[model samples]
Target chain A: MILDLIQNSFDGLAMGASYALLAVGFTLVFGVLRRVNLSYGPAIMFGCYAATWVSFSFHSNIFLLLGIAVLGSVLAGTYVERLCFAPHHKGSAIAAMVASFALWMQFEEVVTLVMPKHLYDFPPMFDAEPLAIGPLSLRAEALVMLACALAICFALHRMLYRSRFGLALRAVTDAPVAAQLAGINVPRVLLLVFLLASAIGGLAGWLIVSTHTQVTPMLGMWSTLKGLLAMMIGGLGSLPGAVIGGLALGVLEAHSQWFLGPQARDLIAYLLLFVLLAWRPRWMTTSHG
Target chain B: MTALLEVRDLVTAYGKIEALKGVNLDVQQGSITCLLGPNGAGKTTLMMTIAGILRPRIGSIRFAGEEIAGRPPHAIVAGGAALVPENRLVFPNMTVLDNLHAGAYQRKDDFASDIERLFTRFPRLKERSTQLAGTLSGGEQQMLAVARALMSRPKLLLMDEPSLGLAPLVVEEIFRIITQLHQDGVSIFLVEQNAHMALKVAQHFYLMEQGKVTFSGTPGALAEDEVIRRAYLGSARA
Candidate 1:
């Protein structure tokens, strides 16, 4: 029983890592652009589809497929920035948000029309066997996801704190008019942020697909809501808040499955989110920028 | 010295309300010029229009003989003009050091030495290099703002209300810094509320009311004018 409990905890943590990635992407985009990218979910789903097709067509390695997925998402984000967001940039925030919803629906429908609705199971990225380490058992794919999430977080922190580009991005996020006068291109920095966020989302899709061995049209829909919730519960636009909130949600969610049963887990997640929001109304508008 | 900045009948507006009405001005190289007036004088509007933060409704602004009225603020800075905007618009979340770095954002050259120079000049900033700018005293934040603008290595620095809400000692320090910069051969365009401080620092001054340049003269000449005395100094003692 103790062994199972420990295994469950590891599983919870690994799952939380994925949520951490999703929440980071969501919060980063919102922090800079001040508009949530609803298209992110459909973009993630399409990226998964592209990854599956690449692996199937060329019999390429999982790592290569992961690279393609990330690249595809980056391109998608750029296209969205150029065609949709930048032009409407000076307009109302709600207009940009509604436009994102339209883009999301359009991408989702287009991908569905092109691909089969039935699940296309992907092969396990690593050896099918789970590793037993003391009291904990962890799948290789979960381990890889956890490492990738941690590495990405660490790299981002360093980039934000150490690099020139990161400084300009932060300045633009904080006070755009002052940033402009200081010679930072506010729009260009925001575009780069969107690209980074989409790439992270694409990597998340690839990881989720690897673990589940399944790809569906709606794969990212639930994760998108969860990501938004995590961002809100933490603090909108704060990097640390997103990471903490994501990890907390992941652990609570995993344990809910063990304690309350799988069917009612989502209700518990929502309840916790509600409780957090009830306690901290200011979290909704908080941003380090 | 040649004119470093030239504005020809510049007109700017907020929708239907015209704020800058055919205003013209010239700032000579290596001098401190002040624009002074009562509230609603459009002094801040002119500054914003010149800095490319707001597009002028009409007229032209030339910086170092290049047309820069319609360019974005970043491009305008890249052309060697920087504005320390009204209210000391410091990035509140950033540390003093970070704010200084941000001021040099457009320059590809190294800023470490310049930053060191600034820290050396303002030991208070050096003492609190890592403290968030919002936490700084109002005077410290204003100093940080000026230091940040200097990081751009601007040929012309436009300071809007640098002395606003500052303590008398702090205001004196700011004026001293302005004089030091002027002595160091940096051109300054000052928008000021304290007429006495402006007279002390400026080589030339313009008085504006209702978006028009009502008077322009040397401080000594303005002090002697009867009309200017009644309007600005409120009955100048003969």
Candidate 2:
């Protein structure tokens, strides 16, 4: 029983790490543009498929695959931002959301047309062997996922707090007019924000595909929904909150699957979200830039 | 002295209503100019028009002898003019130090010395260097706004209601800073409702009412007008 519990917790941590990346990406875009990029899910799927192609064609190392995926995702995100978000940025948030949703549907259709198969097996980057320490056996991929997540979070924190570009981003996020007065190019900052967030989302996609060993068109929507849920649970604009919320959601989902069976996993996870939000509406409040 | 900024027949409108109707003014180089008026007198609209935050419907804004009307705000800043916007709209989520750095966003030079210079001028900002600007007191926020505009190393500084909502002591401190900045060769274009304070530091003053410049003269010339003095400078001074 204890071994099963340990295994479940490890699985939760791996899933949480990926969710953290997705949630942070979503929150970063929201913080700057003040609108949801519904196309974010498809962007991640694009990264995953791009990585799959690189792996199949070149048998490239993990670093090369990640690089291609990130680049591809950044390009996709930039296109989405230019076509769907930029023109409607100063307009209604609902309009931007609707536009992005349409973009997302178009992206899914393209993915389906390109790869009609329901699921394609992704090439594994590491051995699936469990690394055992005493009685606690954890998958090596899980540990790697956790480590990568933590590293990305630390890098993101440093970029936001210690770099000049980060300073401009935070300023623009807080007040665009004030940022303009300070001589920061508001449109350029917005573009950089979309690129950064999309790159992070791509990294999350690569990590997810590595663990699951399968790439499915439905993964895009599912990953986006889970990431959005994690962001909402963590609070909208806070990066640390997204990480915490992602991990918490992952743990809860894992435990729910264990107790109520896998079929009840999403149902229980969403119910918890509803209850938490109802109990503390202020939990949605974001404190930091 | 030659005029550093010249506005001629400037007209700015919001939708159907004109806020600045054929207003003309000149800011002389190396001198402090003040614009005085009551609320809705188009003072802010004129300032915004000059700063390129608002597009003038009809007029030419000449800065340093070059026509700069209808330029974007950042381009205006790059052309050596900065505006300390009304209400001290400092980035609240940013730390004091970050806010100062943001002020020098267009600058590619080593701004360490400039930041150090500002710290010496506003010691309170140094004390709360890591604190968020939103958490600052009203007086400190005002100081920050002024310091931020100065970061652009602008030759002409346009101030809008620098002492809007502050303690008497803080208001005095703002005036002192204004005087010091002028002494250091920064030409100022001040907008204020405080006739008492405007009369003290300004070399030239213009009164705007109902979208027009109704009066233009020195402080002594302004004091001579009984109706203007009573309406603006209070009855005791009149």
Candidate 3:
């Protein structure tokens, strides 16, 4: 039982890495804009679908597919930003969120119209066998996901703490008027942050699809639900909180699925979210220190 | 040489009600000029318009012998003028050092020396460089706000009510800094309610009432005017 628990934890961490990336993207947009983008999952799905379409049309390198996914996500995200967030920046945040949701529905319909099929095959990131050590096995793709998540986290930390752009972003987040007086272009910084978040979403999408070796429309809602869940579980607008929340969620899900079954796994996840939201943990309220 | 800032026929309105009705003012080069006004006397509106944070309905603002009206706030800051905003709207979550960095966002050159110089000017800021701006006392936050504006190395500093909501002793310290900055050759356009303090530091003063310039003259003229002295300068002062 102990070994099974450890093995499940390893698998859970690998899955959680993708969730962490998605949560990071969500946290970025939320922190800077102070508005939620309901269509985050749809944007990633749009990117993944674009890559899948390209793969179906012509055999391409996996790296190229990753690039296409990222590009497609950024394109879709820009559209959402321009159409939804930017227009309502001065008007109402509620209007912006509603518009984003409308766009989310639009993305789903557009993807469905373009691809007619319910599911499609995707190229796996790694064709290697699972490595076995001391009666434990780990997938090579899982290891890659874990490494990418950690490296990206480190890079993001460095950027936020050590760069001029990061300082401007934080200033804008703290107070937009003060930021403008400081000569930091507020709108441009917001757009850049949105683009960054979308790019990260694209990466998360690519990681998840390639690992599963399948693409489906449901992936959009799945990614959104998981990302939002992870973000809430971690904290409102904190990067590190998003990461820890994502990883913890993944482990919880994995263990529940192993013990109580798939339905119970989801039930427990939702229940945990409900409890966390009700209790309103202190860590969930504060952003970065 | 012309005044550092020249405002001609400036009219700014909010919706239907006009806040500034054809206002005219000037800050001479290398002089600390002050604008004295009560609440809702269009002082903040004028400061915001000069800093390019508000769009005037009709006006011409000539800064350093060039027209600069309806330009964005960032452009104004880059054009060698900065506004130390009212209420010291410092970024509350940012550390003091980071707030200074944000102020110097537009500069490409090395600002390390500027930081050192500001630290020398405001030693309390340097002592609490790592502390967040929100945790500071009202006086320290005002100092941080002033220091932040100076980080842009502005040639003309527009300060709006620097002495607002501070203790009498801290208010004197703030006035001392203003005098020191004026001595260092920085032209200032200040909006103030404290007439006595303004009388001491202001080379020229303008009294604004209900969005119009009611009085404009030297400190001697301000004291001699019976209407102005009884209404604003307090009954205890001559």
- Candidate No. with top lDDT: 3
Tens digits of per-residue lDDT, candidate 1, A2-119, equal 7666676778778878888888999888877778777777777778888877877887588888888788778767776776689876777887878877877777787677775667
Question: Which stretch of 10 consecutive residues in model 1 chain B shows the poorest summed lDDT?
Answer: B229-238
Q: What interface RMSD, in Å and to 1 decimal, does model 1 have?
A: 1.1
Evaluate all candidate structures by whole-model CA lDDT and list the values in order.
0.84, 0.87, 0.91
Model 3, residue B111: distance off in Å is: 1.3
Candidate topping DockQ: 3
Full candidate order by TM-score, most accurate first: 3, 1, 2
- In model 3, the clashing pairs are none
Error of 3 at B105 (Å): 1.0
Worst 10 residues of 1 chain A by lDDT: A280-289
| Tens digits of lDDT, candidate 3, A162-213 | 9988998899888888898999888888899999999999999999999999
Q: Write the per-residue lDDT of candidate 1 for residues B23-123, one digit (tens) a residue.
A: 98899999899998777878999999998889998999989999998788889989988899888888889888899999998888888999999998899
Instruction: Give the per-residue lDDT of model 2 (tens digit) for B40-111.
Output: 888889888888778999989999988999988888999999999999999999889889999999999999
Off by over 4 Å in 3: B13-17, B222-238
Candidate 2: list runs displaced more than 4 Å.
A54-61, A281-283, B9-11, B55-58, B222-238
Instruction: Please give the C-alpha DockQ score of model 3.
Output: 0.75
Cα deviation at A82, candidate 2, in Å, is 1.1
lDDT of 1 at A249: 82
